[model samples]
Structures are given as structure tokens and as C-alpha cells.
Target: MDHQPLVSLITVNYNGRAFLHGLLESLQACRYPHLEIILVDNASADDSVAFVRSHYPQVQIVENAQNYRFARGNNIGMARARGSIVGLINNDVVVDPDFLQPIVAAFAADAELGAVQPKVLDLQRPGYLEYAGACGGFLDRLGYPFLRGRLFDRVEPDLGQYDTPLQVFWGSGAALFLRKQALEQVGGLDEAFELHMEEIDLCWRLHLAGWRIAVLPESRIWHYGGGTLAQHHPQKFYWNFRNNLFLLIKNLSANRLWRVLPLRIVLDGLALLNELVRGKWRHAGFIARAYLWLLAHLPLLMARRAANRPWIARGAARTEALLYPGSIVWEYFLRGRRRFADLKYSQAFTRRLAYGRHLSPTQMEGVEQPYGTETV
Candidate 1:
């Protein structure tokens, strides 16, 4: 940590001209000495590239001939990145001046650390946690990803509840920090994902390759949440459902995959049924289409699974050890556990090692409460 390592900050933009000023302005105030900024423009219809060229001439620009969406756009930028540490930041996010320092320090502290996510607060809502990634991300037994400070639609207020740096299942894509070596080892974000859940998929591979992912709460950023696709967008639903299945297929061990996947499909069917009962035809259609896509692409998914087997065998840790043993969906809806603290089964997650250290329930005291302390 004697000398600052060169850090490349890459942001993918698509018709995000209006958001560039805030993001670029905030980055200009960053305290990090060795910093490189790159913007990957995905054929933005707006004058986003021209505006950056006119205003921020120091920033590097990579223009795509057509819209490559999130995953591929980021991959393109990362490929052009020269720094040892590369960051994939969203165009709509604004960071704290000292954010890059902590991220760099975390990487310097742990050689196995593959990725890190800063504590993300909502830009519009002040102290509330951002919906995409609050204080890192964790997955339930069923492959449902949720955050420490935000579960489903419930986002917690940033009251220093999760201030400690802790190991997590995945880092948020909105403002994820990555080691260039790790990216090379596991490969870039899956282009097939195109958008949602791609970061989770990448982190899952990192874990399988014996790399650690964590949330460094000391560094922070505020996100506008949905810049390209709105929360309720039909495409978002399709990608979330479809890519989640892709995630499980590609990463889950053979012993667990059979048990978990069928249950996940059943849950998706229940979700589709609920939407149908509510007369939400579009939502139901999206879910149904996800199933159809799965059926049509079974061979492709099997190939991806076969490709990832070596990494899975190389990993010393069990994927299930890092996952919450219970169902997040049942705990949230059926048991009425809204806050992350209210979930009793979270205590089971202490079995996993984080950042090369064993973390017991006592070690994660403030971050997670003891079981049965609160009731519905």
C-alpha cells in the first residue's frame, strides 16, 4: 500500500447525457492519485459522447457501433482498461471523494479479494439504502439475491448498522470494484445475461474460483437505482427470472443443483400464478416466457455448467455454506420478516468463512442479530 495502484473507473452509458455531469463532477473530486476514467458509450442516441469529449477531455471514451447493453458494454471497457484494479460503475452513480481509497486498500489487504461493493445509499432518498445494493449482497438457498440493508422492496435507513467490512456472496454491479487479474481468471461478465443479474453471476464465478467478494462500508456511493430499466419494466422481470436460472445452472454443484432448481421453477410458477390471479397479464407473460426460454436453451445451459465444472472443483469452499439455509421468500412474505435483522435463519450463515477469516455469530454481532429476538 506504499504507492497508489492505478485504478481504472469504467462507466457504460446509453442515452445518459443528463446524468454524466453529476457522475463526472463527483469523480473529479476523488482523492485517489492514480485514477483512470473511461466511458463506454453504447451507441447513445443523445450527444453523451460529444458532451464528455467537450467537457471532460481527460476521460477516455470507447464507442460501440450498436447498443451492447450492460454486460457486454462493461466487458468492452474492461478489456481496454490498463490498470491493475478496474471498477465498473453505473452512469447514474455519484461517489464520495475518498471511496476509491478504501476499495484499493481492501484489495491491497487481501490477495484473494476479487471484488468489493461500497455501501450504496439512494440518491433521491438521502439516508435510505439503495435498492440494487445496500451493504453488499447475499443469496438465499434458492438463488434469490438480497442485500444486507435491503431485502426485496424494503430498504433500511443507513444508521451505521452495517458499517463493518464483511464478506458477501456478490458485489453490486452499479458500483463494483474488481481486480483485473480475477477478471482474467474467471472471464468477464457473461454477455448472454446482457443486463440484470450479470454481476451476481460474475461474483458467483469468482467465489467458485477461490476468490472472495465483500462490501467495504467505509467507502460509499449514492445511486439513482434504475437508470436504463425502471423497476417494474417488463424486461427487468424477464431478465431477473431468466438470468437467476442461468446463475444456478452455471454455478451450483451437481448435488445441490437438482434439489434447488426444481424448487426454484416451482416458485416461479407460483409467482406467475399470483400475477395471473391479480390480472397482471404482462407480468405473467414475462414469467412464462422465462420458462419457455429455459426450455428452449437447456443444451446451452448444460454446456455452461460443464464449462464451469473445473472452477467448481478448484474451489475449497462449498457454495451452500455461503448461502442462507432458509427461504428468503417464505421468511419475507409468510413470516412477515421485513428487515434483514428480523430473519432468524440468518444465524446459519456464520458457518462460512469471509475474507479468509472465520466469522461466527459473535463476530457479526452488530451486523446480524441473534435468532428469536424479534417477532412478527
Candidate 2:
């Protein structure tokens, strides 16, 4: 651990010129000595490539012929990366100068650790957690993804809670750090995901391969959330609903799939109805479109599940340890658990914390209370 491993930091951009100054400047000031920055442009009409080349000459640029969006763009950049540890950061994110040290230290400490995410706060809102990735990401039994400091739309403030480095089901793609070997073992990101939920899908595959994902709060970043796609955009809604179904199909086991898919369809129906009742016609229409897409592509989804069967069997026994046993949708809508700390997780999640065996005493020092104790 004496010699620092090379860290290749890659950011995918599509006409995001205004945000580049903050991101690149912060990266230039990074304290980690062994770091290289890569900028992957997705055929932006804006002069994003020229701007980077002229201003940040040290950054390596990879230009795509067309807009490949998130999954494929990062995949292309990762292919060109020579670092042992690869970090996929969003173009709108600004990192702390010493962020890379803790991330690298965490990987050096645990051989099984495959991915890590920093505690992401809002760039616009000083104290609040960002919507994309708060402390770390997790899932419910029903394939609903949520974060430690964020529920559906409610985000918690930085109050010294969630300070410990702990194992999680997934890390946020906005500032995700991964071992290149693990990414290759999992065959990299599933490009079919296109945009939304791709990182969660990648983390699911890593879990299936018995690699742990964690959040190191000591390394921090600020995200200008929804820089590429607006939060309420219809396309964002469509991708979220559709890609979530894709995620569950590609990763869940057969028995769990049958039990969960039917219930999820019913819940989606309820959501559509609620959206229509609230006069949100476009959102409701997109939800229906997602269902139609699922019906049309059943064969493709089934083939994907079949291909992943071997890994599914390998990880089946420990799956429950990473997932919340209850439904997050029900907890959020019916039980009024808006904050992540308000939901009561089962013992399975508690046991999952034991996976953080490599966490140093200093990292766990001030974590005086367990989760669900401090409700905002």
C-alpha cells in the first residue's frame, strides 16, 4: 500500500460546457499525485471538446461520433483507461481536493471491495444531499432503489450522520469508483440500460460476483443534479420506469422475478392512475409506455436472465443481506416514510454492515448512533 495506484478519472459530457470549469478546476487541484483525467464527449454540438483541449491540456479527450449517452460513453472511456482504479464522475460534479486518498485507501484495504461512492451533497443547496446519490445507494426486495440520506424526493442535510464507511448494495454513478478488474469481470455496464439505472445494474452484477460496494463519507463531492436531464422531464420518467424493469429482469432470480414482477406491475398501474388523477397526463402516458415496452421485449429480457443464471445461482444465498425485505414504494406512499432514517430496516440490512470489516477505527469514530435514530 506504500505506492499509490494510478487512478483514471473519466467524465462523460454532452453539451455541458457551462459546468466544465468547476469540475475540471476542482480536479486539477486534487491532492492525489497519481491521477489522470479523461473527458469523453458524446458528440456534443457545443464546443465542449475544444474548450477542454484549449484550457485543460492535460486532460485526455475521447470524442464519440454520435451521442452515446451515459452507459456507452463511460464504457468507451473505461476501455481507454490504464489505471487500476477507474472513477466515473459526472461532468457536473466538483470533488474535494483530498477525495481520491480515502477512495484509494478503501480499495487498498479490502480485496473484495469493487466499487465506492463519496457522500454527494447538493451544489446549489449548501447543506442538503444531492438527489442523484446521497450517502450510498440501496434497494428493496421489489427492485426499488433508494439512498441512505435520500428517499423518493426528500433529501437529508449533513448532520454528521452516515459518516462511517459501510458496504451498500450500490454506489452512485455520478461519482462512482470501481476496480478495473471487477468491471471487466462483470463485463462492464449493460449498454441496453441506455441511461437511467445503469450504475445500479452494474453494482448488482458486482454483488452477484461477490464483490462489495461501499460509500466512504470522508471523500466528498458536490453535484449539480439533473445537469443533463431535468428532473421532471418526460424522457427521464420514461427511462427510470423502463430501465428499472430492465434492471430487475437482468439481475433477479426466477423465483423472485415471478413473485416481484406481477406485484410491481400492479403498483405501476396505481402510480399511473395517481398521476392521471393529479392531472399529470404526460407522466401517466410515459408509465403506460414503459409497460408496453416491457410487454414487447419480454423475449429479450428472458434471454438476458438466462445468460445471467450462473451468477444468479452463485449469489442467491446472500442476496437478502443486501436488500431491504419490505417494499419501499409502500413505505413511502402509504406509511409516509419520506426520510431514509424514518424507515425501519430489518436485521438483514443490519448484518450487511458487518461486510465493512476493513473500515478503519478513525472512519467509525464519531458514528455514535445507528441508522433510523436521527429523523429529519
User: Which residue pairs in candidate 2 have backbone atoms (N, alpha carbon, C) closer than 3 angstroms, thus clashing?
Assistant: none
**Candidate 1, residue 132: how far the Cα is off, in Å:** 0.4
| Candidate 1 lDDT over residue span 68-87, tens digit each | 99999999999999999999
**What global local distance difference test value does model 2 have?**
0.85
lDDT of 2 at 212: 81
Pairs of colliding residues, candidate 1: none
Error of 1 at 224 (Å): 0.3
Candidate 2, 127-152: lDDT as tens digits? 98889999998888788999988888
> Where's the lowest-lDDT run of ten residues in candidate 2?
367-376
